[model samples]
Target: MDALEILFTASFWVAAIRIASPLIFATMGELICERAGVLNLGIEGIMTAGAFAGWFTVYAGGDLWTGVLVAALAGAMFGLLHATLTVPLGLSQHVVGIGVTLLATSLTYFIYRLALPEVTSPPKIEPFQPLPIPGLSKVPVLGEALFSQTPLTYLAFLTVAVVAWVLYRTPVGLAVRAAGENPSAVEAQGISVTAIRMGAVMVGSALMAVGGAFLTMSAFNSFFFEMINGRGWICIALVVFGSWRPGKALIGAILFAAFDAYQVRLQQMSGGIVPYQVFLMMPYALSILALILVARRATYPKALMIPYQKGER
Candidate 1:
């Protein structure tokens, strides 16, 4: 193939990685939390909160890194709320998640309106550029495809590796898995299931926040209403689709992202032959399909969607 043809094809794969980065992070976060026996349906809300927090930080003269920090903080706060409701109070996880989603959406819209009065021409920030590795960028097509990616993409891969290590090779990971499976037994052993669960939830929330921050600071560089859309929810579905395993969830997240990436390409190729609305529904459609697959497989967390009572533990 010609050099330009090679570049074009390589760029397509790179674009898919860029598009999938946020999903990968969020999915991995959800996987960890779920593995701890906590179902964080509020991932969507946490992500939305992060998106606005990150965007406003940038709008207010902060750098991209600062925005990301704020986003992680926002996510942690939301996670705290979720943890309080479902952990100590013993409220239904489903209710808490739905409440978080509603609250986050309303809060984001309210702040966005109050902060940006002029909708006609909103200000935008510059996004992160791809940072190539020192030596990896020169190895032909695969090199550019793998190394020529934004910092967040590199972070995503690093996150997966770290999480995999922690999940499979660490002492704390054992506690987390045990907490999810048999809380009372874990508590009897004095390991503090509640503490482990709380820690997991907060960590997961921070990761989800970064995922949202990436959408604004690195992926799009601008925030619109409901900027996260339903990406967070997709991550939640991915937990089940991936059977609550971090590695599997990462794969599922990437697969979903690939479907989305290809859907866009298909729409462009159709040249309006297929309605744009139809193309827009692809992610949701695939999400539903994933849910169906999950139902058929029945591989969700054994204790997912259940509130954990302190005494019960």
Candidate 2:
């Protein structure tokens, strides 16, 4: 009935989780890339391509899961492209990333036009329904809000713990971190820096693709031009805000999602007391402020953006 009551409801949080799901996926993808010392500005385009891949597959009579797979594969291909250009070829990471984004964006649009030329309205697909956990859904306030989530949301949260473990406790995780911070030293340790970086980009882009697929298959159930908006860029910021850790990235994503969810509700409740666009701006503006607050405290990999060729400093 009132602001506090509206804010405290389970339904509101359910929306928050839904909005944050894609962001969580994107953040983790970028985290993986950055951990291996590759700054992926192609994230926006990769997500865009993923959305198109999923939507196109489902529209062409494939099932949702298959569409998801296609999306992941599509993302992986782009990641490989990025790795090929930036790693072995020794191209500039920034330039390659921007080129990948531009190429993916244009290519996706061209494919869309070629596939469905007579469409006046955007096509749609059946999205995943929320699955509520048995006992967990019985709790008040937190139950349905946290437990009654789509499968993708559950995966997103679960990934937090999994990634934290992988990064902190596993040898592969150490290699990923080491690759970004000191590739030369890592090379000296008998590891192929190129191989590790290549693998990281491939895996990271695949996850980023899944995030984009989540938007199409779960979040909205349809694909529109530039639907990814700037969420990919926001995710880049989130990685910085989270200090490249899964737990922190998840927190930052949820925080931004909360602002996003509240803004939508506020527009309905305020009845034009505030402009809707102003509400939309809340998340990005908050991100800037959050980045500013944490910028000084943030720690980044030492040798990030430096390419490693054998016997070269």
Candidate 3:
């Protein structure tokens, strides 16, 4: 298919949506952290850890959903460590975040080596299967792209809706936002900024782990090193691309995914004519362009990445 023709194809969009699924989860996770005034640079390692944790759980005889839960718990533990250092201790968020990433990544690799001692190949698990919605899956390209995905993909979409609701429609959301924007005001309201920021980080990390689990449990049935492949970092940029909003972040994920899907197809169409690296870089290049456009007008939270100490203004 030609470049333009591919855009109109159902299969193209199906691939795009599938590619976007994990990204949506991670982007939402980052959005939550940033919204509550934390910068989680540990996402790459957290995703790596989650990918291993979830797949290993299932490989060791746990159910699929249970695997997902274990991954979230694992992510939360790391998130807790990050929060303790950054929130209460008021350490450099950048340094601590990078430290958390290294620690989580190293620890996960150690566990993997210890668990699989003699296995040459990564073990496999029965991953989640697609469940097409009865009426909606029949609605042309949109149906196949949106409604005919694994349950986790649906959950990713639901997460965006839930995040938007919580951030804009609920009181707890207000507190979270306030903690990021004006901690002193939140303190005046008798709320604990520490608690809110820490909670946000933990919850956000949980979702990021789930995103990693999706790589193992849905996109592929086995866990492998480097499988996450910088998707977590891409999610960070996606949060900025979406202006820290769930819906916009969702779009950013899909747009990036579309670029990715298109690139693969373009590679096929080029056969041996063009260098493969050019095609591989297409999605990221496009995403950077998109981020540049969106970030200019993006009004970030006032206290994002600023350590908030209660009663100290």
Clashes per model (N, Cα, C within 3 A):
0, 0, 0
Each prediction's TM-score versus the true structure = 0.92, 0.97, 0.98
TM-score computed on alpha carbons, candidate 1 = 0.92
lDDT of 3: 0.91
Clashes of 2: 0
Model 1 agreement with the true structure over 1-313: per-residue lDDT tens digits: 4423432576666777887899888888788788888888888878888877887898899987898889888888888888778876778888887898788778877888888878775578887888998899777666876798888889998999899889779988877887787777777787877788888888888889889888888888788776787898888888788877777877887777767777777777778977999989989888888889778876655665566666763
| Higher-TM-score candidate of 1 and 2 | 2
The TM-score of predicted model 2 comes to: 0.97
Which candidate tops TM-score? 3
Local accuracy of candidate 2 as per-residue lDDT tens digits, 1-313:
6877877998998898889999998899999899998888889999999999987899899988898889989999999999999988889999999999999999999999998899978888888788999999879877878898888788888877877888789988888899999998888888998998999888888888889989988888888998999899899999999999899999999988988888888889989978888988888888888889889999988767888888998
TM-score-sorted candidate list, best first:
3, 2, 1
Reference-based lDDT, each prediction? 0.81, 0.89, 0.91
Task: Find the 10 residues in a row with the least total lDDT in model 3.
Answer: 282-291
Q: In model 3, which runs have C-alpha deviations exceeding 4 angstroms? A: none
Q: What's the C-alpha lDDT at position 49 in model 3?
A: 91
Q: List model 3 lDDT by residue over 1-313, tens digit each.
A: 5679999988899899999999998899889999999999999999999989999999999999999999999999999999999999989989998999899889998999998899899978899999999999999999989999999999999999999999999988999999889989988988888999999999999899999999999999998888888898889889988888899899889989998998899999998799999988776677678778887798898899899877687
